[model samples]
Target chain A: MSSPAQQSAGKPVAFVSAQALRARMHDAVNDPHLRQSFRGAMDFLMAKRAAQFPDQGELDSLRSLSESIRQYSLSKLPDLLEQLEANLTRNGVQVHWAETPEEANAIMLGIAQRHAARLIVKGKSMVSEEIEFNHAMEAAGVGALESDMGEYIVQLAGEKPSHIIMPAIHQTKQQIAKLFAEHIPGVDYTDNVDALIQIGRRVLREKFEVADIGLSGVNFAVAETGTLCLVENEGNGRMCTTVPKVHIAITGIEKVVEKLEHVAPLFSILTRSATGQAVSTYFNMISGPRRGEDKDGPEEVHLVLLDNGRSQAYADEQLRKTLQCIRCGACMNHCPVYTRIGGHAYGTTYPGPIGKIISPHMMGLEQTHLLPTASSLCGACGEVCPVKIPIPELLIRLRGEANSAPHANPAMVGQGAAYDPKISLLWKLWARLYARPATYRAFTWLATRFRALTPTQQSGWTAARTPLKPASRRLRDMVKDRR
Target chain B: MSSPSHGANTPRTYPSRPQAVYFYGTCLVDMFVPEAGMDAITLLEREGIRVIFPDNQTCCGQPAFTSGFPDEARRVVEAQLDLFPGNHPIVVPSGSCAGMIRWHWEKVCAGDPALKARAEAISARTYELAEFLLHVLGFNRKDEGPATTVTLHTSCSARREMGTHLVGRELLARLGNVTLAHHDHESECCGFGGTFSLKHPDVSTAMVSDKVASLKATGASQLVTADCGCMLNITQRAAREDQDAGRACASLPGEHLATFLLRRTGGSPCGDQK
Candidate 1:
């Protein structure tokens, strides 16, 4: 097996220009195997989700209720956070606030050092991935292991999770069999999925017993009952939180709700939309540490509330909808652009449609401006969204923000990072021609009169298709000359 | 109706067919595909409706609006807002442009406080041509020519914003002698997302390549759609020059639904067309 420092090899995508993003996209598109894999997978996911929503009326009502709940909860976020803190503290759980990844990592490391932790086992947590938690732990000479089967495969390969829900979805079973043979003892090379999974489970099972601390991600944090809810199909999430002496949970600030009742509808829709499952196998609700003869639970519990640009997204009225996501991967499964490029090409913690809108808040627009422009405004993300985020509308708004002249009081973190005066001037010039009826008419008339001069090779348009040409007469001229 | 409520069963109530309707010929039809606009007008006029083609109309501000240039989009859409002053229904031949005018005009006008109400009023009466034909004109296409099969491509905007994919299919179902071939992923986009094709050519090309493959797999002799943007994108990808075909070699001719419907009902210019 690999050493501890080398094992926690999670990489954050560098801030690259649009040209670099285009290069990555180009490579991904040209990879025929990658394209076919994504096409088949997305088609399968789309059909499954469609089958689950057989009754449109039921789906519509549930979605509306969910949207209302998320919006209402976010509207009273400050109050809910305070209430949640008070209740958690009373329950003997420690709560810490973090405004950045550095603060979040420092707080976690401090918690680990207090216990003199040698090893930390993790449940599947994308928030931890967002903060690069494993890398931080290894840097401090402590080993961090992923207990979930999918996360284990990704961690063994030294790669980030391509899909949040299915971390190792991008890998083939043959590749995984090879990984197990090389990384685990006495494991023969076999493409059988069951055998491969058993080998991984055996390794993780041993790690769970001797690990000094456990870490997890929160799906919903209810204020009224001081509960942290984690949803998963596998039982590893339960093992990670219960088997160790200490448990630490991290989540974005937007995951809190005012009441335990609000979780019912959100969970109902989230599982169905995410993987077409009516319910996950485990819905772990941890109230606090073990006390008063509670023998199976952890002795100490800690919760880290992460801000990490969520406040920036919440500052703007229109941009606030980005926080409404329940982390369902339905948008990525439905997006045509995402279907072609897959997840790794995005080079962000979150990938596909949800990632495009949210990554800008976490990483400034200077690094992620090209992400919004990647979509075709197909509205598939917005259409399938359980909370109705209106993703395409947000894409248009972000594009405007990226190009507009910077204001003294900007709403976004990296606003105007993509502003180019030449393109701005061209749009302004094009507007002048279009907004004036006489000018547009004359321009079209001249172009049609000299239709033969139309170029056979226009820019990117002519790459895959024939050239576009003007008709001999404009529609207005034809209608006008009709006696 | 709100934008999100454009699902297939939204219970739309259409106005009665008027004596006249304004034809908002979109820019794609104005320059590249004028025959589609002309055929649509012929179809409307055959139903005893006077088609008034506004002389001053230009592009819907969709190009600039989606390109993140809201001010420019507002200016262009605000100008077209003045062209249609009457209370009569405004019929747009292209679903994308119609959806923009009907669903998104008021959105682009949000920056201009003065034009917001005007944009909303104009949006209220705007209707996509096929929807107008089905609900208002009650088009009963007679299939004047021979039997043929065609596949229809519905733009994402129309499918999600106006529920016109069903409208387009409903219109095709009305034709007595025509068979509508089913294509895989019919509800997906064709990648003619206005400026998206220009900015991300490689990705856009890859998307349309898949769309073309799906359309061609339908094995229909003709392909038709309600949006010119999709028609333009798909036809270009479908365009192949056969040496034997000589000057008439558009292997799979992707055309406007308006033109296809007109040919089936009112008779083709080249009589007895496929």
Candidate 2:
């Protein structure tokens, strides 16, 4: 990934600071229209979440069960991949296992060449963004148009996604109107949200009809039945997978599940966690391409399982839970920091708590060291997590792991470790003095003798705020006096 | 003074409160902000509570735990457990240290079954100073602290793990002299994450800068906090800025909750709360 500075310019996310983000959110939250859209959506999902379990006990049980399922799936990933391939092949769908993005891109280009594909209508997929599939496909003389409304707006604006669910969340309707005018020529620009949605639908509907091939992302792939699942509200995923003669689905290997039963629990957790909705509008389960009396489906189906450092993640027990992520983007929503800066500032395909942990491992730790330290180690991510992955704990663990690793940014190791005791001992005497209350009291009395001599910002603590002066009498002395 | 309250009359709840609670007068209160300890004791006593000052109650092993010395942290936590025996809740004024004790006690005491039980018992009862004030002691502070406007910084450990942000707001509202205003990023850490300042000073300093910016945004004249670690951090930064500019900004440097209460009682919380 490029530097944060570069990505942020293209994205131009307004709320990069936690304070700024909170201020903007507070302002926008009170606006009637935005509140109806944002909070109404959140309330609907939160209600769905509450309805699923009825009580905290059921939620806890579900979290534990889902977590164990993910653990088991990750443990048997290698076996499951082989099983999924065989089952997919038996069902007449081609299965391609890609070790990296380069390999995945190569396979995609080969497939496109064999079929003489020209224009590809694509569904919105973080996995596709992860591999920069559009850039690769375009480089190979194929045009890729995003069919998701939020995604199309971002694509037209020439920027990466600012939010996982709401790709263009940072953009105001007015800014989008300008973007549509500048990019979608001869179109009358209207800042109305409904008008914008209609415009997006008109553009993608045409692209969907003429697309040589349909490209999509699988939300979950069942190993037992070789079925690929795609869940979305817009129905663009349906069009992307069925309207074309050849349908190609690309997803990470971790997206594979051993059985259909495993898919439901995850879906139950993901939909509510992602949108606070009980379930998405559409949950398409595709076994293979058009066969027998199928009314409207693709002629050929292909499933590409991209590794891209996923296999390496399974090797380390501390990092395996990362694969359990359902890509709900709930962590980003509640994250005080991410809400401020938005996703683009992280400069990774994945952003927020999960991004911070996975990005360093995938993109080489040195380049992404700053990512882990960006957090305040707040446990909000872990609390709202449907699967109950200890994200904050994992992020801290990653920091420890990063310390020992060899990386491109060697200078940062020293810069980051400035708080280590080897640097300074500002509280040395204070620490020793507080070892016993008697001594601590005596020291306080003596310090009180010179209470006026206290320096406001004595040492390293001076970097933050003005120090309050110490009290003249100790609490123990006050207790004794009361007695 | 060990209380006689440890007899069999009390039935044990899943979260059983100890007969005699030991107030771990953390380093900040024992020295810099001692009056905070007095306020805690008064609040606890008012609720039919018997308090014990564990003179041996040193630091919450935060310095050692945060410094990556698990063994040393264990030693400190072990000493703390010894100081306050039985199932008594260990309450302290500083949310940061209370969190370190409540959260890290198990991790430090892992493997030894006996130590684990003792640690878990303590962890269950370990409450940050104000959480006990609002939740356990239940003494509403609505009548304290003069009506001076102030911003509250939700220390990282306190707000994230202990969930004390609203509790602080609730108690601060009770104070007579204080009108609590929300900081722009009140929930963000003030950047004094234990040894974070020493180990990653550049990042720590940058974080502190943001924290300072957040505090400034509140436009309040004073910054009040439950964590002394944060108070120290904000104090240090404010002083540095004051020194650099050669002028005192409108903001009051750093004042702990105890000092606020003490000053309120003394009829001048804004300047000499302690």
Candidate 3:
């Protein structure tokens, strides 16, 4: 594994290489525990997803509808943002718009200042990770607490979530037991899944009590009725939103839906595609905060709508649909590359198929130069995508974008441009030549005919497989003779 | 749903009623393994389908288009439309090519007003071979063969693009005495993304190496795949490992779908059969 210094220096992480990661997976994935965990988890999720759709045929219809919905949302984003803000404000909630991460962090810090927030409890949010919200909060003298089980595990380990939906998908029970033994109090180290959950629950309970401000990430905020929906398995998001005196929800601007009705069908696809679950264990919808009849809910609510390069992503014709993502993590779960290496190998907040697309956009290519090239571009992510983002296509585009970024590639031992077009162009021409049969054969014939002149027994291509020993009869030659 | 006798039916008397079929021999089988194309036609003819090879067919436009040369690829699309004019239900052996023709041509060709109609016409008729066999011909494997264990490496282009995994399995099941073992990461790409291997050989080599390793873990002697690109990579990797391990790698080998099915069905390859 490459050290954090290598990462900070903008050198590519070897452990994060798609190739090495895939290789590592082929060995470690076969372990009984990992396989069993994967099988059990995937099966449970798939079952839940299948059960959600009364008829399987509805899947295609839902996908098409969801695509249209997302397309419309992107097309009318400015209007939707105004509408969402107006409605949220009408419901007695304060809404702040942050155009960049720096601005978003400042806005969040401002909220913490108003509440005199010493300890802030948080629900799982990839957006929060996008801005490194925890680090910023700590820097501003607010101690942040992650309540989500997976987030909590990754937090303790000082690593990013390997998988988006299952934040701690990379860590084994044994690893967690060790982490807990070191971090959590009064627990004998045990690899028991139930025991670990118990430890997390107790630790989170105390944070909830002391937390003056609850910070949560919005899955979707409906503009029409001013409703915010959060889907979670651990039930921590609800406590974070409701237990604290002041509740604040943060999300990317693209997460806003046109109406509440749009949430139901999309949620159907989201949960199923994400974990194969028919429905999330908890689907909490908050309209403002405390109501007249409501027993338990936050007294004051605030929403921070984050742009943070999303506006730029929306401007790109090919990339805009990436906003359609519901963060279901279906693409990751089904992704062959992701399942093997787990998520931490990605070294970003968002891991897997969606991560490859969103990471560079969120973190800037300088910091996330490697995430895009991490795909095989097999188009598997496109196939399983519920809203049909054409993920592989976006991944390719991101790679191109990364090449233009100043720090994408390490400074060539000194100062210079990271990538050069002339070198890439020559490489492209060589590829085009090999791809064409006539050209490939002509080149092969020239090389093989003068075999003695060529290097003998080279290691990579030549040594392993014998080169096409000049075909005794070339097709063109045979055709010419026949003519 | 054009009938056999509906169009220009130049039927040759081979002692059977020829069921009309359109040949969409993919670029791989066309340029590299022409034998697979020949064998596919032979198999179809044996079951009474008169295969029509439209000579005007250029490429499926997959290679150029995937490489981001969609404008240049439009000419190839025009040539394909000229080759097969209407709905003849063209059957292709390669999954990626079939998928490109069936799904992408219409979309890529949508910009050109002249090619749009033809692209739409061809997309409706193109079918991958396994899909044509199981769904169209209703052919299922029911015989017994030499009991050998083999693992099926689902090519990414086939699994994600053409929906060939289940259909390929259904066709493979007909071969007697063959057990299909599956690798853990079956849907992962073997990294043969056309010019991707040449342009990014290091990355391609890395992906294929992992694919070969995954196939080996299945404990199956043979790794079978439908895509020739995947076959090339797997075979190359296996051969490389065999060279390194000497006798240790002898137990495992790689084969294409045509070779595998042909062997099991008691039909020798054209080179060997005669």
- Residue A386 of model 1 has an lDDT of 91
DockQ, structure candidate 3? 0.19
lDDT of 1 by residue, B168-254 (tens): 888998888788998898888898898889888889999898888888788888888988898889888777322233656666787
Q: Candidate 1 or 3, higher DockQ?
A: 1
Per-candidate TM-score, chain A: 0.97, 0.81, 0.83
Model 1 chain A weakest 10-residue run by lDDT: A10-19
lDDT of 3 by residue, A27-91 (tens): 54445565456545654654565466566457767887887888877788888888988898899
Q: How do the candidates rank by TM-score, highest first?
A: 1, 3, 2
Give DockQ for candidates 1 onward, in order: 0.69, 0.22, 0.19
lDDT of 1 by residue, A354-432 (tens): 9989989998888888889998898888888999899998999899989998878888877998999999999999999
The RMSD (Cα, Å) of candidate 3 is 7.3
lDDT for A315 in candidate 2 is: 71
The list of candidate 2 runs beyond 4 A from truth reads A1-65, A404-464, A467-483, B1-19, B28-32, B45-52, B55-58, B61-87, B109-118, B130-160, B163-226, B229-274
Better of 1 and 2 by DockQ: 1
What total of clashing residue pairs does each candidate reach?
Answer: 0, 37, 15
- Report the Cα lDDT for residue B128, model 2: 82
- The whole-model C-alpha lDDT of candidate 2 against the native structure comes to 0.69
